[model samples]
Target: MSRVKESIEVDVPVRTAYDQWTQFESFPQFMDGVERIEQRTDKLTHWVTKISGVKREFDAEITEQIPDAKVAWVTVAGEGEQSGLVTFQPIDPTHTQVTLMMDFDPEGMAENIGDKLGFVDRQVKGDLKRFKHFIEDRGTATGQWRGQV
Candidate 1:
């Protein structure tokens, strides 16, 4: 098991940040390794990702959520076993600090090699940076899903 974490502060509201994060399908706009995300249900999501030329598919179940605050999820099926959380902390009326944390294990050969070489860490940082740019450019989220499980 390996843990990779990164964070970035976005010039947006807490709710804005949270809402944007909820749009799983929009992840590809910032998340480099992600190819697509399907919001299957209120608490379920399917993901297809290609990283370092290796692709994998997975499903995750939202474990916990707090409006305008945080979202957490755990992978339930796929080639990866992991869990992660994204939290939105308001710095001001128009600024929010987004923090992301994930715990995962490298599954196949490519992932294992990539992880041991710090490739995964660098990618995570890159992803966060992209996310910053993405949210900043957008100014507001596309939509929000606030329903409970």
Candidate 2:
């Protein structure tokens, strides 16, 4: 398994950051390889992504969720095996620290090579940076989900 962890500080409140993150459909805006995310249900999501010219689809189930705190998920059915968690920590009313941790098994030669070379780590970092910009630029959440799971 390959694990990647990345974090970024955003100039937004924890609620704002967590709210924006709950809008999974907006991930394509900041996530590099994501093509689309469909919220099938409150705890289920379908994702389409393309990385390094390779495309894949997957269904992920939210394992645990705590509003303004954390969200955890695992791939239920997909072309790959993976799990991830994202957490939001309040630094101040106008500042938030967001952290993402992912564990995945490379499925193909290309993916394996990328994992071994730290490509996945760099990608996670870049994604977090983009997310920081996406949220900080807006200065507010596009939407919010407060339901617990």
Candidate 3:
């Protein structure tokens, strides 16, 4: 397994940032390589992603979720073994620090090589940067899910 951690500061409130993240289907707007995300249930989602010419589909279950604080998930059944957590910290009323940590296992030669070469790390960083822009530009969440788990 390989791990990647990245963080960014967004010009938005913690609640705003966290709420936007709960809109799983909107991830493709800022997350590179993500083709689509379908919220199957409050705690489950289906993901379709393409990276480096490889396309994968997976089902992820939200293992833990705390509104305005963190969200964690793991692949329940999929083409890959992966899990991740994202946290939101309020710096002030108008600033939020968002962090993402992910763990994944490379399946084959291509994936193994890419993982070793820091491909995943770079991708995560880029995705977070895009997310910063996305939320800051909107200045409001598309939706909110405040249920606890």
Q: Compare the candidates by lDDT and give the number of the best one.
A: 3
Task: Give the alpha carbon lDDT tens digit for every residue of 1-149 in model 2.
Answer: 88999889999999999999999999999999999999999999999999999999999999999999999999999889999999999999999999999999998788899899999999999999999999999988899999999
Whichever of 1 and 3 has more lDDT, that candidate is: 3
Off by over 4 Å in 2: none
Task: Give the Å error, residue 122, model 3.
Answer: 0.5
Question: If scored against the real structure, what TM-score would every candidate get?
Answer: 0.94, 0.98, 0.98
lDDT value for model 3? 0.96
> Model 1, stretches more than 4 Å misplaced?
none
TM-score result, candidate 2: 0.98
Q: What is the lDDT of every predicted structure here?
A: 0.88, 0.95, 0.96
lDDT of 1 by residue, 1-149 (tens): 99988888888889888888888899999998899999998899999998877788999999998889889999999888999988889999999988889999887787788889999789888988898888889898988988654
A best-first ranking of the candidates according to their lDDT comes to 3, 2, 1
